[model samples]
Target: MADTEPEKTAPQEHVHTSTDYPEGAQVEIPQGWMYRSRKLGPITFPWYASPQSQLVLVAFVCFLCPGMFNALGGLGGGGQVTAYVGDASNTALYSTFALVGFFAGTITNALGIRIALSFGGIGYCIYTSSYLCFDHTQNFGYSVFAGFFLGICAGVLWCAQGAIMMSYPPEHQKGRYIAVFWGIFNMGGVIGALIPLGQNIHTTSNSTVTDGTYIGFIVLTFLGACLAWTLCDAKKVIRSDGTRVILMQHPTWKSEFIGLWETLISDPWIICLWPMFFASNWFYTYQFNDVNLAQFNTRTRSLNNVLYWFFQIVGAVLSSFILDFPGMRRTTRAKVVWCSLVVLTFAIWGGGYAFQTTYTRAEVNKGANTPLDPSDDYVKMDWTSHGYIGPMFLFIFYGVYDAAWQTSIYWFMGATTNNSRKLANFAGFYKGIQSAGAAIIWRLDGLDAPPPYMNIFASCWALLAGGLIIAAPVLLMKIKDTVSVEEDVKFTDESVDDVVAHKIGHEAVDQEKV
Candidate 1:
């Protein structure tokens, strides 16, 4: 042929024969299949690589245990508060316990995932189970000790579980995962409320004193232990002696602690998230306290619990689904947060009005010397006339709003950040800030003042709402899209083959990386 160059020898295709593979290699579908699929892109929908069965099981167990425990604590707190009243020593003791929990969380954060989780679960089981021994006759010393131990356990459990959940799911899937887990967990609160209600009902039926509430705690503790075992089994490699030994090495220990500190201080996203998380905590704690306020106004403990459980279920379910909508996803995390804050403002204002009305009516009733029927609904100041409809509506609104905000924030955090170490550290810092906020609220309560409950509640809510509103715009402006790791790494035909080969060659490595 006129200018035909020597026949180009077909490029000799050299197969990659070396056994060595890139660290943390994952199996990927063939390029042909991926190219054919419309959704094949960097930010893969459904975030996680096909749901990890073991992880999902472990997560379910984790959710159940904490949910039950927290719910029980909510119920038990009222009784403990009543029992320890006017005991200055007990107040000091509660404070000390809370302080210990604060420190324990910091330590857990420094320890990394494996060690922290193992220790945390075991510790929680032991301390939480001890609740069975508590009673009205127990002195302030006992109450303090119980509270202290429980606090330590709770702190560790919270920190460890949070790290585990965040570590497992990719960023985009975080909202859905968190919402499902949290909804299940909050169900424990419902169960907890229900247990007491059941006990109350039984006591009413049998004409006996309400003495079997502790039984619920015992049952929950056992369930928690079983779940703890599952968690332990799920990650056997990390539990091995070799891993433990390596972690104890002085250099490793120092590196981990330093890394934790650095992560807390340097992360910009985490810094922005702290205030919002703090507000969330305040709102949650406030809700817990509202049960007592409801009881006081309605003079029926059963009504309070029933209303709470009802609203919590509704709110949790609604929030879970609503957050998944495209418009409300990661990009609108701040907007969700702001909406919660605004709703909280109205809720608290409504609560204050209710309180003021109750106070005025109480004074009138006291002056008149009439024997008040606790269950009477027609009293002008009775917020319970509608069976806590006012407070219930408020709680329902807050719960839904809170759920959406939490889902958005956590999802955004997990998706946007690539570093797992940093995510764990940020979680610790965020929780610590939450504890600090709770402490501030606790201190601000003028317990000695003349029924300043309404003022205290109103002021805190107003301030929290205002702070969130102010910060919302700033956070919204800073919000950005998440970058997918898959997108950044190019995938060619050969690369796809390599990935598939790697998975076949080393199943263990693929599992570990995923």
Candidate 2:
């Protein structure tokens, strides 16, 4: 019995080798699991490594393109009012533009990601450049045409860019990435505003148009081309084994569009978050119109431009760091958003009221000799008195709020999707909502008698703020991590040489058993 107990089977050994399977062969195992092997090419790092960086660069180019166009508007000021389609009212111009934008933007949204991004860039450059062809001699029809083209271009570009930004990186990193992305992107406003300050050497009398503006457009267009190329070249890595699996080609629109919509609507957080983002865009558009208000002030075009740039820069810089504070860092996304909404309301609506009141009071005390009319339908400021303080504070406040809103939206997107293509399409849909809303508001402002400027501002602020607050809890409730089945895979250097490698080590013994 003791001799029988000493008997033992020969030791068992399992040997694994790379050549165990032929190149490009498919491997199948028990329980319906399958693996494939293919050699992976060298990984090429994109110009912008992370999605945040890609988004920021894209946003930056977007901001710059508009800045040049907007700078033209800044230079025109209140003195040279161009009629669009026989409608001289600024509200009408904005309204007509918005109406066209809504339709075109919606179509763009439906086009999904790849088509939208590609066509959007090409159309944007073509349409934006067309603005340079206009002269004072042109009929209102040209203005309408310009507006139509501009609206379409802007609508498409924004929708595409937003979707692209949403598609990048880990969920937790979304906040930080978006904050940096938007902060840098919005800083383009400062860059755009500064161009006018430097180029203002040619007075209005020298030429109806400034030559520098043409040069600026060229530069902006070139930058856009560079950004588009970078975006197209961005690297996507799928971690398999302990190594990264590089996906070299861009995603197809057909494969991703429906999936993106499904992911967006399926999530509880995104449903609530979408409307809030829509509100954020409306407010951002309103900020651009502040130039209209500023025109009424005695400040020179150069001075106003300087102020605009200064405040934007300060605001963007400050907001970048402020949102990272530990107390603010991990705060519920809803609360952070609500806080930003409050600040935005105060800065845009409340600040506008305060400034108007200040101007009105000054005008009355001065016996109306100041040429300042509180009832006027123009934007005015006392540049000498404030020396950019008013606009600075206003922009800084806007920058802070805008940064927060962008961060929350991106974070929400990252949490909801594993596919970047889907992120890009959803970004399009979300931004389309923004452009559509802005177009309507802008047009309505054009239609109002005396434009009820103050009342309109107040009303928009109230509605947006109320909407955000009410939606906050619902938006952030039960923020959960998305299901990423790909996370279970691991990759090593040897495995990186091949697209597919499967093995179970001592560490994976328990995992495999389970």
Question: Which has the greatest TM-score?
Answer: 1
Which runs in model 2 stand beyond 4 Å of their true positions? 1-43, 46-60, 66-118, 201-209, 232-257, 260-265, 268-271, 284-302, 305-334, 358-382, 385-392, 415-418, 448-450, 481-514
Candidate lDDT scores, in order, read 0.45, 0.45
> What's the residue-level lDDT of 26 in candidate 1?
37
Task: Tell me the tens digit of each residue's lDDT in model 2 across 101-135.
Answer: 33442444455434544454544444444445443
Which stretches of candidate 1 lie above 4 Å from their native place? 1-26, 29-65, 80-136, 202-209, 232-251, 283-286, 289-299, 327-329, 332-357, 360-388, 405-409, 443-451, 484-514
lDDT of 1 at 225: 46
Q: Model 1 Cα displacement at 217 (Å)?
A: 0.9
lDDT of 2 at 145: 64
Cα lDDT of model 1 by residue, 444-466, tens digit: 43143223445556655665665
